[model samples]
Target: MTVDNLPLIELPIIDFGPYLDPSSTAEQRQAVDHAIDKACRHLGIFYLVNHGIPQELCDKMSVIARQFFSLPFEEKRKHKVGGEVRGYWFTTNAEDLSNIPCEGIAFHPPVNQCSNGVAPDIDPASPEARLPTTHDALGGQHSWPNDHFRAHAEELLSHIVPLKVRLLDSISNCLGLSDASRKLVQNTVPHIAFNSYSSLTKAQMEEGVSNLVEHTDPGTITILTQDVDVVALQVKDSDGKWCGVKPIPGSFVVNVGSSLNRFTGNQYVDTLHRVIHCSEKSRISMALLADPVFDVVIEPLPECPFKTDLAKFVPKTFGAFYLDQVPEDH
Candidate 1:
């Protein structure tokens, strides 16, 4: 579809800064929660302005990313992802997302890394001990970039990770969750990735080639930042239409993911979305997928509307749940 024919329903934007402020009044926080509850149930994708991430840090991330992507083939390959998938992985056409040629670097901080989402000191006979997972391979170690990507990446994480926590708290409030369940955020293993896409030729665009195959993310939520003035993102509205996600200055595009839909008893939509093929400018986005650690079962909360219209919530462990959601071979 051309830009003009896009649906009239624009993805809503919420200035979450005040709501996330620790000193904000309950009314202020509740108002933001009301808006978020509506967005989660309907749009599932929205722009979060004043989300506390500094614009200067975002700009620095972009510059460092561009510099690294411009490096010589040999230099960029030095930290390539091999067996662990923890480093730079450059490819022409990715098997998972068609028409999008991109490179990605994965990072999983060890602070929150655990098979059962707890420290090793917990008693062995406890239920958490029985749930140790095999997917711990994706965390623990990371490849450092030789081209000054380390400093900026670290700083970005320091800022973005806590932002994820605040956003999660806001969402929990929207769901009317109690304090005990809200504390469940500690079990989340945040996986952050830096992605850059190559531009496609006009012929490819005309031939119906796509930037990314349509699919919902597998985690609880995805916080994204893209290069300014380059609009390649799209989200499927409730009516089965593809609509563009316009870049907003100093904002992050946060979307509900599948795990969250299950957690909320499908009250929120884990919206299907994809990157559009760009014929002009380059595409770069940093995404942090705040995922529940393995073995933590993500099921519907006790107060899920539990309507017949939604999918049945299952008490599926995060490890098995996320693996089954991986996009199948094209």
Candidate 2:
């Protein structure tokens, strides 16, 4: 189905209030579920309102993020660890789309500390030394500009992480898999990024340089919110036309990702999107990308409504899937 045919304007506005309310009626909850299902299968994107995340917290997060991004390049890059997954990555006119022209910092669960205070005999440079045997290779201690930044980031995540769990449950229900889908997410280690895309210079814009090239997120789900009035996000429809998604105040843009797309046997759309310069001001957005744990198999759910005689894809571990999507440099 083309995006034009969907019963929505640009994107559906879903009231997550019903899903979070204990007193909401069954029909009210079902209405929420149906709206999510339609959006996922048709466009894989929607504007989520009444999601219960405090507006003040969101505002504070944006404020701190901009402060961090506005710091001197040397001050910010002090925490950057080369060839590591969990640190600041600053790129300028990247040769390929894999790394766009932006400044980004990622936060991940920390590596486990040895309880006995004795370092293992393994080589410190080896993968085994940096990550636990059970962790995704991406798992490690995060690098932050300072404790103040870390505190606010974690506080925001404290609220978002739990909300994502509930969202996984809702998507599971939409797929008719009940708790099965939720179970896959139990061990998920989320990777969230605070990214800043500086406005294109007049010369760059005239040269048709891209800020973020068209691509689909590889995780199970991506929850994103950008600074107010920074309208650069664009979604591509089935007909190959791109439409800008206006940022709604206090609402998050949620979309199904590749991992979830494969789980449903490609039944749901994993929308393609990109970013372009909208104004002279820079753009800052927080993206929380959630995927299953390292060892979890990503296969079509047996209970999904779209299950067919032949599986659409071969089963692969989420870790392997993630590795395939990473660029060679990092």
Candidate 3:
């Protein structure tokens, strides 16, 4: 079938059951590869099924997220800038300023090292003590009221971090890397965020005022779990048409980010994407941004680099590149 006639629903939903099975047959591996190729090509998006994250847990997380966002503005503000690692952010607090119009890209800058104001009791050397900065704005202390939210947020991280590692391995395999070469991702430090967009009025939706402007994610990989009925996410198709991505119940969307594009020497495409504010309902989403550890070197893969002139390309450490592009606080 022609690309247009093939299916209105062209996005791929990949099943991970085969990868988890000890006795998985060769055909199963081939099937997985096929899915990965298609997802990386036609649309830089995919639905992951059988990923082992419990449906009940996802539902509970969603409910709690809704509750958290529903709190009075003042109560929610208790977790605002300048406290510990957990809190809330208002609309327009974090954004990317580099885009000429800053239309679709919501860039959140990194927390500045000096002003983070982390508690004295929490040692900086501790792995768990680092905080995700407020969206590309000022990096000061996170203002969380108590320990309850902190504990739950940590629990969610515990569940998803390893899954992210495994998925990265699968991605590495798709690039024909050896098992040991998967080490390319080992030292990566990933950031995760739970964000809820306030419901927009019909007029706001029509004007695209509450919608996220188009931009590509800057990290290596991004995995997102979104509200089932919310239909605001959209990606540019090969034909440059805007296509809506409907959330699949019990699945997450995975997309490659800019870092991965550089690592693959641009062999794999990292497509542009954005979100529209829901007109009929508010939307909640959990986003995970995974990148190599600060010290890990990011160079183009050997095979892919030779095809393009390596001499003209610029090389910068992953951390340096990310910090440079952090969205300026509005």
Candidate 4:
């Protein structure tokens, strides 16, 4: 269905430019507050603009993504999961094949060790099981055809990670939590996966052969950067009907995930969304998942009063719940 035909809700668009000013204007703070309220009350989704990230950087990242995914299957396979930490992955390979409920392993441990005397867990037998890969170096040493892209990817990561923290803090203030409560999530390391949806032809879109399946992101927040003209992303509304989201240039789609739901005591919405192929032209988008570190404890903000069962509302570590949801290969 077209974006207009479905029962989809429009989220807010927050501009961070004014907030970045040294002498912040009254209107700026009000704008931020308005955006915060919209995110908390309505769908926990919004389009971010003037976020300080350069257009050149965004363009370059998109180029790298398209180039990497366009590599020959054999070439792309060279970057496969030789170890758990970094590499490339094919579509659908991220599915957990051992959990009863069935889910995908979207988070990967940081490449470095944490300060709490905790070592990042590594799986020798199944490197693929540890995290999503981009290249296919199954049994070989991991390598990249273009090393320059690695630098760009890391740069993007550096900027985005901190931005996520700032956004989380805004969320905390909206909930009226103290600074200490906000810092509770400061050390929460995010496992990011840079995803690119390939441009599919009409036949492929009609056949539904290449698009992602219906599922909710399993993290605190999922930020996406998609092509401007493509029209294939869809979200299921409260009425159980699929609605399309129109592409707004220089705009990114943010969806609240399960982790955020737990952290906020269910004040935000973590709705179901998926991508469908369009016959008009090919499409590409980058999806970054920001999740808490595996060991960090998740609990509802104490200030949020709710009549619902506290046990149900209390948060749980993502790793504990994510591991249990791994699906089995039939």
Candidate 5:
């Protein structure tokens, strides 16, 4: 169910150029902060412009993603996930995502700790029970493509990690958070993903199959961009109606996720978004998501920018809570 009324059309398009400029005035920074705060509380999403990511890098990542996904099914299958959902795998037609077949990979930073148990209120049968690999090795290492395109693909993550740092810091300032609360965000090791959505016929689109099922991100924040000329992003408004969002050239779609929703005392809404069937062309997009080191506690701070009643936070550990939200297929 949705809890907001602001339409996606009127979404705030925030410019980051000013914030990054060395000579930017305090007033300009404050304006940016206000924009972030408003969008998160009202719509839970916003478009980010002038984020300083080179256009060439974005284009290169898209090209490499399309190239990799275009490989023969057998070739891609060689890199498939065995048990952990970290490498390349085919996305089957589930009931919710019918007609939209896709595949993607998730890459987490070096992590060795097995997931800590969930909060006392969680169920034993939950996905949270699926612990990560332990023993000092980073869990779920991604299987890089076997082709020359691998370098370009890997470089995408390099650019994305630093971008996430800038984003989280800005978000911290926007929330007027104390250093203690900000630590939850700063401790997050970025996770990068490359997704390729396959083309769908008109008939399949009419049959109600979307490129993805509606869901909210489990991480703290998500920064994503679609390939030029590809569109079909839809977000559920507070009225619970799906609204399409067209691509804005060279801009990124940013959304607060459920993790931040919890820690922010529900001040920042975790938005539900989806991609729909697009005729002819397959769509490629990449996302950089962030969550604190698995064991960090996510409790609402005493000071929050949005008007929220702090009574709702359940005080769950980041890793345990994120595992619980993983889709069964993953």
Candidate 6:
């Protein structure tokens, strides 16, 4: 028999240790896979604990994000990466999105810029080494505030990219897709966002003004690390009620995005979520958005157990789907 959706009244916290362990039995790994599949189908989101990313690395990421966002707007904008997709972006309350002011910096994986998809020559001293031509939408120069920030950020990517690959492999197994599906996104560049949101006033909070508007992610999946002390993130549950995703120390939030939902033939819900300004203190989060390679055709695989004859989504390349769905301002 196939699996059923899990209850979505509360956010599910999944222990990923078993899947991460080489000595784990088949049943142990399968249990984790089922839990992930259930969470994605019913709530589209869950918290992952004991996922093998070091606490020191998480702490370092949090510290560096806070330190960089704390800088003055003028100083921060100086390093703007400048594109619809990458670099620094600061929006005024009137410019819209949430219709509230916010600050963020985006970076793509190093492979995006390097032709070989590995080992980019980003030596600071070699100014001419930076690629003059971008490979695709995923390829671009990543501007940074300083050498220190770049080092840590790149280090985080080195760890998290592998995590993304491993997680995708598990998801493929859950959906009964071939092992080849695990590498469907191997060439894609995942975008990393370091976001900062300021606390709103009592009047604004009372007005139900969201710091980020409700929307589904357009990519395949998102793995997010947020401030442990904050409680502003919320996800729309199966019943349509918004549920808060409370911060868990040393954990990351993983959610299905629209592309993955389509790939799974709508079996996995594309999560609708937003951030509200409820805290007196400001909040910061680091999110890694993973997508398939731009040229990937997004039709459901025949091996996917959830795929039906009357497919709900039309076939399209990942690049085309992204352009059609995502706003350029973002």
Clash pairs, candidate 2, are none
How high is the CA lDDT of each candidate model? Answer: 0.72, 0.74, 0.62, 0.60, 0.72, 0.75
lDDT of 4: 0.60
Q: Give lDDT: candidate 3, residue 297.
A: 51
- RMSD to true structure for each model, in Å: 3.8, 5.9, 7.3, 7.4, 6.4, 7.1
| lDDT score, candidate 1, position 116 | 39
TM-score, prediction 6: 0.84
Record all residue pairs in model 5 with backbone atoms less than 3 Å apart, i.e. clashing.
4-238
Write model 5 residue lDDT over 1-330, tens digit each, in one string: 121232345568999877679899989888888888889988799999998888898887788777877777677767765534467755665333422356776666555443322233556578654333334233345677765556775677677677678777778898777888888667676777888787765666667666677899887888898876755678877787777676799899999988888777788889998877464678888888876777777777667544566566678777667767665554
> What is the C-alpha lDDT profile of model 3 across 33-109, one tens digit per residue?
77876687566678888877777777776677767766665566655554222345454533432211111111122
Candidate 1 residue 271 Cα shift, in angstroms, is: 1.6
**What TM-score should be assigned to candidate 3?**
0.76
Which 10 residues in a row give candidate 4 its minimum summed lDDT?
A: 96-105
Model 4: per-residue Cα lDDT over 1-330, one tens digit each = 223244445657788666556698877766686686577456667788766667677778877766766566567656665443345555545332221111111224433222222433667365434333323211233355476776786687777777777677667666777777777645555654455454444544455443566777667787777777756778766567777777777767878877777767777777677776543444566666776665456667677555356877545565555444433221
Clash totals in order? 0, 0, 14, 18, 1, 0
Q: What clash pairs does model 1 have?
A: none
1-330: candidate 6 lDDT, tens digit per residue: 000121224678999888678999999989989999999888789999998888898788878888888777667877676466678776545344332346788886443332324424576357535343445454346888789888888888888888887788778888777657756634456778898887766666566666777889888999999988867787776667776778899899999988888777788888998877556567889999997765578877666555456546789887777767644664
